[model samples]
Target chain A: MNHALVSLACHAYVVAALVYLVYLVRQMDALATGGRVLVGTGLALHAVALVGLFGAQGGRPVGVAQGFSTFAFLLLTIFLVVDVCYRKPVIGAFITPLAVAVLMPGLLLDPGHVMSPDVQRPLLPVHITIALLGVAASAVATGVAVMYLLMERQVKGKRFGLLFSRLPSLEFLDTLNRRLAVLGFIALSVTLVTGAFFSSAAPGFFWTWTSKQIATLVAWAVFAALVGARSFGGWRGRRVALLTMTGFCLLLVSFLSSYDFIHVGGGAH
Target chain B: MEFLCIGLSHRTAPLGVRERLALPEARQVELLQRLAQSPNEAFLVSTCNRVELYMAAPDMNRVRESAREELQQLGGPDALEHLYEHRGEDALVHLFRVAASLDSMVLGEAQILGQVKEAFEKGQGVGAVRGELTRVCAAAFGCAKRVRTETAIGRAATSMASAAVSLASKVFDGLKDKTVLLVGAGEMAELAARHLKQAGATKLLVANRTLARAEALAAEVGATARPYEELFTLLTAADVVVCSTASPVPIFTKENVGAVGKARKHRTLFMVDLAVPRDIAPEVGELDWVHAYDVDDIQKFVAENAAARAEEAQKAGVLVAQEVARFVRDRAVRNGVPVLAQLRQRGESIARAEVERTLAAIGDGLTDKQRKSVEAMARAIVNKLLHEPTARLRSVGPEHEGNRLAGAAAELFGLEEAAPPTGAGGPNVVANGGKG
Candidate 1:
C-alpha cells in the first residue's frame, strides 16, 4: 500500500514535470498556471504517501528508498513555499524533474533495513531529517539558479524570444537563489552538528571519514562559500548560478554513491 | 440583404472633402432622422478618416442616390468624384472590417472600433438604427471581438516609442524598479522617455550637453536633469539609457561599456541610441549585458511587428467573410417571413370556410367541445399542407433572389400583390422604424 502511493505520486510528479517543460517552450501564462496546479496535485499525492509510510514504519525511515521518498517530499514542500513567496513561475520547469528523479527509486527499489540497532534512535532520525531538508533546499536553489542563468543569457544575447518574456527577471531570480542557498547552508550546519552525536553512539564510527561523509562535508563547504559570497561579496547572476549547480551535482553524486548515513557499521541496503 | 453603404474614406477622398463632410453630433442626428423615413432605417458614421451612410431599404440604387445627394450637399460637388458604394453582402463585410480595424488607416489600430461603437450608440439613441441595422451592427461587433481574441492582430507595437517600450518590457519583465537615463533633450528623446515613464519606469534622469535645455525637457519627460559630464556615472546606475546626443563622433565605446558591466555587476542594460551619428559605439552592443538599438534597428522591428499583425489580419479577414455570408443567408430567410405570413392567412381562411360549410351541413349534431376540436383539426391540416413550401422558402439566400422567391409564392397563392423583385417597392414589409 505504501509503495503504491509512492508510485502514483512519482507518476504525478513526472507528468507535472512534462507540463512545466511544455509551458517553458509555449510561454503561455495559462500553461504556467496548469503546471502549478499539476505540481500541487503531485505534492498532495506525495504527502499522503509519506503519511502512510510514517504510519507503517512508526516514524522511522526504512532504508534508502524511504529516505529518498521523504527527501523528495521535503523538497517539494519547500519548492511550493518558495513559489508562493516569489511570483516566479519558470523555475518549476527546472525543479519538478529533480523531484521525479529523486522519487523514482523510492517506488522501484525494495527498502531493506539500513540502521544499526545500537544507534541512538532519536538523534539518528533528527540528523537524517535535517540533512534531507538541507539537500532539498539546495536542490531548489539549483533550479532557481538555472532559471537565473537562462534569463541572464536571453537578456545579454538580445534574443527576445519566449524565454526572455516568460522567465523571471534576473534580479528576482538572483535574490531567490541567495535566500534558498542561505537556508540550505544553515540546515547543513545543523545536520553536521547532529551527525557527530548520532554517528559516535554506534561505536568506532565517530568522524570515520567514510565516502558519504567526505562528499557531504565537501558539498557543505561549497554551499557555505556560495551563501557567504552572495551575502557579502556582491556576487550574483551567472557566476553564482554556476557555483550552485556545481554544488548540487556534487550532492547528487554523493547521494547516489552512498547508502543512507544511518548505516553506521550496518551492511549496505 | 437590402443594406447599402455610400461614403468617401481616406482611400477615396482627400482630407479637404472628408473634413467638410464630417458631421457634428446634432448634424448626424438630423441627417439620420431625415433619411430614416424614406430608407426604413439609417445611420451616419462621421470620423476624420471617413464619412459614410448605412441604410437598409428595399431599393439599394435609389437609396444610394439619395445618400450620395446628402453627402454631395454636405461636402460639395467634389465629394461626388470621391464617393464609393457597396450593397448587400459587400456592405456588411465593409462594416465588419471597419469595426475590427482591418480597414483602418493604420491597420489593426484600436481607436476605430471605439469610434464605430460610438456611432452605433448614437444612431440607436436617435431611433435611426434598428431591425437590419441592429442585427448587422451586433454581428459586426461580435466579429470584431473574435478578431481581437482569436488572433494577435493588435498585440504588436506600431510606433517608434511603443516598440522601444515593448522591447524594454521583454528584457526587464517590468520596469517599476528600474532606472532610465536619457542622454539628450531633443523632442524624440523626450517622446521615448515619456513612453518609458508611462510603462512604469519611475526613475528617469535626463542629461544633455546644455544644462538649461536638459532641465526644461526633463520637466516634460517627468525626469530630473543630470550633468552630461557625469554620463558614465549615470550609466552604471541606469538599467536603460536612451541616447540622442548630437555628436559627430561616438560618445560611448566598448572599453567604457565593458567597464560599466563590471561596475554594475553585469546586470542587463538596454541602450536605445536615436542619434544621426550614433552617440554610442556600435561595438558597445557586442559586450555582454549590454543591448544597443539605434533608430534603424527599432524601425526595422516595428515594421516586422506590423507585418506580423498584417499576416494575422488575414486570418481575421476570413472570419469576417464567414460571418458576412451567414448574416446574408439569415437576412434572406427573413425576406420570406411576410410572404409566408400571408400564405398562412390565406390557407387558414379557406380551411375555415370549408369546415364551417361541412358543420352547417351536419346541422345541430355537434357538441361545443367537438366543434372546438374540428376547428383545431382544420388549422392543423392547413399547417401540414404548407410545411414543405415554408421550409424551402426559409432556406433561400440573397444571391438566389430570396425576395423573388417570396414574390413568386405570393403571386402563386393570389395573396397580397407583392412588389416585383426587379425593384423594391414592396408593401408587405415589417415596418419597424421610429421605435428605439
Candidate 2:
C-alpha cells in the first residue's frame, strides 16, 4: 500500500507538471485550474505516503531516499502556498517540474542504508526539518528569480513576446524573489545552528569540513552577499535575480553532494 | 417586413460628400419622427465617416426613393451620386459588418460598435425600430461581440493616440499609478491625454505657452494646468510626457532632461513628442533613464499594428460570414410564424363555431358541465386535425419554395383574406389581426 501510494503521488506530480507546462505555453485558465487541482491532490497523497513511510521507520524517515522525498514534498508545499497567495500561475511551470525531478530519485532508488541510532537523536528531526524548509524556500526563490529575469529582459529589450505577456511584472517578481530569499536565509540560519548542536552530540562529526559542508558554506556566503547587496546597495531587478539564481544552483549542488556523501558513507552517525 | 439599408460611407463617398449628408442630433430626431409616421420602421445613424438609414418596409423601391429624396434635401445632387442601397439579407449583412468594425476605415476599430449601439438605442427610444429591426440590431450587436472575442482583430492599437498608450504599457507594468504630462494643448496631445486617462493614468498636467489654452484643456480633461515655465518641474514628477508644441526649435534639450533624470532618481520615463519638428531633442532619448518616441516612431508603431490587425481581420471576416449565415437561417424560420398563426386561427374558429352550434342544439336537456366537455372535445378535434399542417407551416424556410407552400396553404384554407375582423366572429376569422 505504501509503495502504491508513493507511485500514485509521483505520477500525479508528473501529470500536474505537464499540465502546468501546457498552461504556461497556452495561457489558458482551464489548464491552470486543472494543474492547481492536480498538484494539490498530489501534495496530499505525497504527505500521506511520507507519513506512512515515517510510521514504518519507527516515527522518522531513516534513509537518503526518505530525506529526498521529504525535501521534494516541502518544496511542493511552499510552491503551492506561494502560487495561491500570488495568483501567478506562470511560476508553477517552473516549480512543479522541479518538484517532480527532485522526487524521481526517491521513487526510483531503494533505501540502501538507514541512519544509525546515534545520528537519529531528537535533534536530528529538528535539523532535517529546518534544512528541508530552507531548501524549499530557496527553490521558490530560484523560480521567482527566473521569472524576474525573463520579465526584465522583455522590458529592457522592448520585445513583448508571448512569454513576456504571460509573466508577472518585473517589480512583482523581484519583490517575491527577495522575500523568498530572506525566508530561505532565515531558515538556513536556523538549520545551521541546529546542525551545530547535532554535530556536537554525534562523535566524529564535530567541526569537520566535508565537501558537502564546504559547498553548503559557499552557498550560504553567496546568499549572504546577495541579501546584503540588496539591502544596503539597493540592488534589485536583474542583478538580484541573477545572484539569487546563482545561490540556488550552489545550494542544489550542496544538497546533492550531502546526499551522496551520507549514502556512500552508509548513513551519517 | 423587408430589411433595407441606404447610406454613404467613406468607401462610396468623399469626405465633403459625407459631410454634406451628415445630420445633427435634432435633425436625426426629426427624421426618425417622420419615419415613425410612415408605415415602415426606420432609424438613422450619422457619424463623421458615414450616414446610414436602416429600415423595415414592405416595398424596397418606395423606401429607397423616400430616403434618397431626404438625402437630396440634405446634401443636394452631389450626395445622391454617392448613395448606395442594400436590400434584405444584404442589408443585415451590411449592418453586421458595420457593427463588427469590418466596414470601418481602420478595420476593427472599436468606436463603430458603440456608434451602432447608440443608433440602435435611439431607434428604440423613438419606437422607429421594433419587431424585425429590433432582432436584426440585437443580432448585429451579438455578432460584433463575438467577432471581438473570437478573433484578434481588435487586439492592437491602430491610431496614434492609442499607439502611444500601447507603447507606454509595453514599457511599464501598467498605467494605473502613472503620471502623464502634456507639454502643449494641441489636438493630438488632447487625444493622447484622453487615451492615457482611459488607460487609468492617475494624474495629468497640461503645459502650454498660452496659459488660457492650457487651463481650458486642463478643465476639459479633469487635470491640472501648470505654467509652461514650470514644465521642467512637472517633467521630473511625470512618468509619461507627451510633447506637441508648435515651436520650431526643440522644447527640451538633452542637458535639461539629464538634469531632470538626476532629480527623478533614475526612474524610467516615457516621452512622446508628437510634434513634426520634434518637440523634445533627439539626444534627450539617449539618456539612460529616458525612453523617447517622436511622431514618426508613433506612426510607425500604428502602421505596424494596423498591418498585423489586417491579418486578423481576414480571420474576422470568416467569423462574420458564419454569423451572417446563422442570422439568415434564423430570419428564415421567423418568416414561417405568420403562416402558422393564420393556420391555427382558421382551425380554432372552425372549432368554436361547431361547438356553439352543437351546444345550442342540445339546449335545456344537457347539464352545463356536459356542454363544456362537448365544446372542449370539438376544439380538441380541430386542434389535432390542424396540428401537422400548423407545425409544417411554422417550420417553413424563408426560401421561394417555402413561400410557394405558404401561398398554397393559404389558398387551400381560404385564409388569403383571413385578417381577424374587429368585433366579429366566424370560422374564417384570424387572431391578432394576423400581424404575425
Candidate 3:
C-alpha cells in the first residue's frame, strides 16, 4: 500500500469539506454539486486506500497505526455516503467539517508503524469498528442538534430568515438528532462492554488513564444524560442541541489532550 | 377573440356596491340571457368577495365596453370603475386560477368550485356560455379539483369560516354556550353557522325575510327558525349575529340593532356582517357593547391563508400550463381534418383523370388484365406522390407548421370560402373530441 495515496485521500477529503463549506456560505448550487462530486470521489479513493493498507498489513490491520487509520477512514466513508444519498445538502454545513477534523489527525501522524501486541489483539478490530461508528453517529447527532437549537431560537423569536430557512424544521431536526443519538448510544455501549471484557481477560495489557480516557468518559456522560432527558424529561430542541455540542466538545478534548498528555509522559494504564 | 372580465370584488368596491352587482338566482338567469344575446359567451362567477363576468367575443374592447354598459344597466354605472377585464390567455389563466381557488380571497378554497359549477349551469340555461368560454370554465373547474387533490393547498390551514370563528373565539374567550343567530340563508351564512356550531355554540337561530327558506336552512343546520317579526327580539338575546343576505336594502339598521342592545342591558354582541350590501349599518359598528366587523376586516386574515397556500397555487399554475398546451394541440389536429381530407381528394382526382385518359387512348393495344395492372400502377404513383407531404403535415404540431399547412390547404382547396369556421365549444366537447 502506498502511504502517499492514503495521505492524498485524507487531504482530498479535507479539500472537499472546504469547498462544501464555501458553497454553504455562497449558496452556489454548482459549487455544492462540485463539492459532492469531489467528496464522492475522495470517499471511493479513501476506501481503496484503506484496502491497500489492509493488504500491506497481511489481512485486517487492527493494530495501533493501521487500526486508527482504518477506523477513521471507514467511518467517514459511511457518513459521506449516507449524507450524499439522503438529498439533504445543508447537513454538509455541519458534517463536512467534522469529517475533516477526525481524518486530519490520523493523516498528520505516521502512516506506517510496526505492529504492537495491544494493537494485534483478537478483539481489537471489533472494538475499533464499534468505537468509530459510535463516534460518527454522535457527530451526526451533534450537527442535527446544533441545527435544532438555531431553528428553535428562530421559531421562538419569529425571526425566520436565511439560517432558519436553510435548516430543517425543529420537529424534523429534533427527530434526526434523537435517532442518531440512540444509534450512537447503542454503538458506544457495545464498544464499552467489549473494552471492559477484553481488559478483564488480559488485565493490565490494554489499560490507560490518559487525558483521552477522561474526555471520552465525559462525552459518554453527556450523551447518556441527553438520552435520559429525551426519554423521561421530554428534553428536545435547544436543550438537545446543547447536550450534543457538549459531547462533541468532549470528543475534541479527548482527541487533542490525549496527544498532549502522552507527549508529557502521562500514564498508559 | 375578446377576453373581457368585469364586475365588483371585495377589493375595489365596498359591500354596498358589491351587493348591487351581486346576481341573485332570479336575476342571474336574466343577466345571463342578456349577455348571450350580445354575441359573447358570458360566465358569471359570484362568490362572497367577488361577482365577476368572464366573457369571450371577437372584439375584446367592444366586449369590455358592453360589459360596463350591461353592469351599469343592471346595477348602475357608478360601480363600473370597480370592474377589471383581462384579455386572451391572461383571462384564461385568471379564470383557471380563480376556479382553482388560487386567486380566491381564501387561497385553495373548496367553495369556489361549487360556485363556478353553479355559474356554468346558470349560463348554460340562459345560453350565455358556449364554445371556448364553456370549455375553459369546465377545464378550470376540473383543474381546480386536481389541484385540490394533488396539492396541500386546500388542506384547511385556515379558511374564511375558520377566520370568523377565530375572531369570535377572541371576543368570547371561549365559544362554549354562546348563542348564534344566522340572519341569512346563503351558503356563506350556512358555512359560518356551521363553524360557530363546531366552536361549541349551544343554540342556533335562523331569521330570514322568507320564513320557509329560513326554516329549511334551520332544519339542515339543527337550528330554530324564528320569523322576521321576532328578528330584533332574537338579535337582543343572541351573543353572535352573522349576517349574509342578498337584500337590496339594509337589513339591520343602527336604530333597530342599537335599540336591541339597550334592551339586552348592553351585553356584549359580536356582529359579523358577511353580506355585500351590508346587513348591519356601518354606524351600528360604533354601538355600545357591539363589536361589529364587515367583509373588509376579514380580508387581512383571509390574505394569510392565500399566502400560506402560495406554493401549491404555483404548482397548480404549472398544471394549467400543461393542460393548456395539451388542449391547443388537440384543437389544432381537429381543425386540420378538412385540410388533410381535401389534399387526399385533390390528389385522387388528378391520378384518376390522367389514368382514365391514358387508358382510353391505349384501349385497343391493352387487354382487360393489362388495364387493371395499369390502374394499380397509377394508384401506387398517387400514394407515393402524396405520402411525404401527408406525413409531414400529420407530424407537424400547432406551434409549428400545422396551422400554416391547414391555412394553406384551406385556401388551395377553397374550403373556407365554402364553409365558415365554427366557434370553440365547451370543455366537455373538446375533451370528448380529444378522446375520439
Candidate 4:
C-alpha cells in the first residue's frame, strides 16, 4: 500500500475517535451523527487499505489481517446497532472509546509478518477466526459489565442522572453478560479444540507449559465457571459482571501473548 | 389569574361521597359547560379516585364560591370540607406536580396522564377549557412523561394491569392452572388479560359488549372470544373475573354472579371491578369465597406502594420541584418578551416624534435625502439604545429590579393582561399556548 493512503486512513481513524469522544461529552445530535458517519467512512477506508494490501502481498497476509479486522468491525457494528436499538445512546460513550483504541493501534501496527507455506493452512484460519470472535464477545461482555456496575451503583445510591437514565438496568445487563459469555465460551472452546487437533504433536506438546496456553486455559476455565455457576447456582448481577471482566482480562492477555509466542502471520496494516 | 382546584379525591372523601360527586361520562360535557358559566377556564378530571374541577379565573373569591356551590349540587353543600383549593403560584405548582404524576394517588403513575388527557378533550368539547387551564393540563402531561423517562420511578412499579394480576394471585394460590375471564374489551380489561396470560394462567375468555372488539382483544392476549351472553357461563368456569367496560349500569350483580358461583360448587372467584360507576354490586364482597375488590381497593394498594416508597417519592418530589422552578424561571423571562417589544415600540415612537420635530426646526440646511438619512439614523439609534436592556431582560431574576421594571412596562403598555405567551410551562409547553 502507498504511504499516502495508509496515512490518510490513519488520520481518518484519529478524527473518528476524537468525534466519538465529543459525542461522549456533548451528546449533541449533530455531533453523534457526525461521529457515526466519520467512523463508517474510516471503516470503508480501512477496508480499501486491506484490499490494497491483499493485492500487493498476495492472499495469506490478507486473510490473517482480515480476520482480526473483521472481528473489530463486527464489534463496532453491534455497538452502533445496539445504540440505535436501545433508546439510550450513552452506552456508545463506553463502546466508541474501546473501538477508537483498537482502531488507533490497528492502523499504526505493522501487519508485515510472514508465515511459512507449511504453517499456512485451512485449520489456522479456523483457529484465528474462532479466537478473534471469542475475544470480541469477551470485549462486549466486559463493556456491558462495566455499564451494569456503574448503573447498579447509581441506582443503589439513588444519584440519578443522564447516565442513570441511559444505561440498562442491572437485570438486563446481567442477562446480556451471560448471553455474551456463553457465545465467548463456545467460540473459545472451538478455537482451543481445533488448535489442539491441528498442532501435529500430542496434547502435552501443544500445551508445553507456555504462557499463551496457560492464559488461554485460565480464561476458558473462568468463563466455564461463570456459565456453570449461572446455570446451576443462579449466580447473577454483580457476581456475573465481576466474573465477565475477569475472563475478558485473561482473554486479552491470552491474545497478546499468543501473537508474541505462536509466531502467527500478520496482514493488512 | 387565580386558580382554584376543588373536588373529592380518594384521600379526602369516602367512596360514597366520591360516587355521589362522580361526573358520569355522559354528563361530562354538560358539567364542563356549567362550570364554564362563571367566566372561568374550567376542566374536569374524573378518574375512579379523583373527581377534580380545575378552574382558572381572574376572580379567586368568586370562582371558589361558585366552584363550591357547583360541587354542592352533588354532595349537598358538605363537600367543601373535603375539597382543597390552591391559588397563584401554589396552584400553578400543584397542577404541574399533578400532571407530572407527583400528586397522583399512585406516585409516578401513567394512568392519571391519560385521565387528564380525557378531561382536556371533554372540556374542549364543551368549550369550558381555554387559556391557563388548558395550558396547565397539557403541561402536566408533558411533565409526567419527562419524569417517567428521566427517573427510576417506574422500575418494578406495579401497573394497574400487574396490580390486578397480583390481586388475583393473592385470591388464588397459583394461576398456573386457573382460568381468567376478561369481561369487556376496554383498556384495563385488555391489560389485565395480558397480565393473566403472562402469569401462566391456563385459559382466558374475553366477553365484550361487541363481539368484534372482544375477538380483537382475545386474539392479542391469546384468549378465547365469547359472546356477552356467555359471560355467566364463562364466569362459572373461571377463577378470576376482571370487569372493565363503558356500560352505564352495573354489568355484574349479586343475582347474576351469585348463581354462577353456586353453580361452580362454591369455588372461589376473584372479582376485580375496574369500572367508573362500579361494575359489580358492593354486596358481592360478602360471599365467603368470592373475593371482590373494586377500583377503590386498587387505590388502597397504590397508596400502600406510595407509602412504602415515600423516601423515593421525596427524591422524585425534589426533582419535580427543581424542574418546576427551572420552568417557571424560564417562563417568567419569556413573559417579558412581549412587554419588552411593546416598551421598545413605545420608546421608539417617542424618540421618532422628538427627532422629527428637531429636524424640522433646522429645515433650512437639510436636503430631502439628508432628512431621509437622518430618519434612518434616528431609528438605528433607538434600536442600539434598547438592545442591551432587551438582552438584560431575558436574564432578569424574580428578585431583581429588572423584573419590576418589566412588570411596570407590561402594566403601562397593557401587555401584562395580554393573551398567554405561546409556550411557557412543562417541557412540551409548545403543545399548549405557554400560559403555564
Candidate with maximal TM-score: 1
lDDT per prediction? 0.75, 0.75, 0.69, 0.68
Model 4, residue A149: distance off in Å is 46
Indicate whether candidate 2 or candidate 4 has the larger lDDT: 2
TM-score of 4: 0.55
What are the per-residue Cα lDDT tens digits for candidate 4 across A68-157? 455565566666665565534556667666765665544445455643334344566567667877888888888989988886565443
Give the TM-score comparing model 3 with the true structure, all chains together. 0.55
Worst 10 residues of 4 chain B by lDDT: B424-433
Number of colliding residue pairs in each model: 0, 0, 6, 2
Name the 10 consecutive residues with the lowest summed lDDT in model 4 chain A.
A260-269
How far is A168's C-alpha from truth in model 3 (Å)?
Answer: 30
What lDDT tens digits, residue by residue, belong to model 3 across residues B1-436? 3455677777677766777777677787777776665456887887778888888765456667767787887767678777776665566667777777777667776787888888888787777887666667767777777788888887854356767776565446456677889998878878887888888887999998899989998988889999988888898789888988877677877888888755776666888887777787877766645667777666654664355567777887798766655554555565565566666777788888988999888868998899888888888898898787677667767452554566666666554542323544321111222211
Predicted structure with the largest DockQ when compared to the true one: 1
The local lDDT score (0 to 100) that residue A178 gets in candidate 1 is: 85
Q: What lDDT, from 0 to 1, does candidate 3 have?
A: 0.69
Clashing residue pairs in candidate 2, if any? none
Q: How do the residues B211-293 of candidate 2 rate in per-residue lDDT, one tens digit apiece?
A: 99999999998889989999899988998998877675688899988887667766778898766456788788777567787
| Predicted candidate 1 versus true structure: per-residue lDDT over B382-436, tens digit per residue | 9999998888787785453565676578778875465422232245333211110
Off by over 4 Å in 2: A55-64, A115-117, A200-207, A261-265, B1-160, B163-174, B207-211, B228-236, B241-265, B268-436
Error of 4 at B396 (Å): 3.2
Q: What TM-score do all the candidates reach, one by one?
A: 0.58, 0.56, 0.55, 0.55
Candidate 4 Cα lDDT to native: 0.68
Candidate 4 deviant stretches above 4 angstroms: A1-269, B34-40, B59-61, B125-138, B359-389, B398-405, B412-436
User: Which run of 10 residues does model 1 chain A get worst, by summed lDDT?
Assistant: A260-269
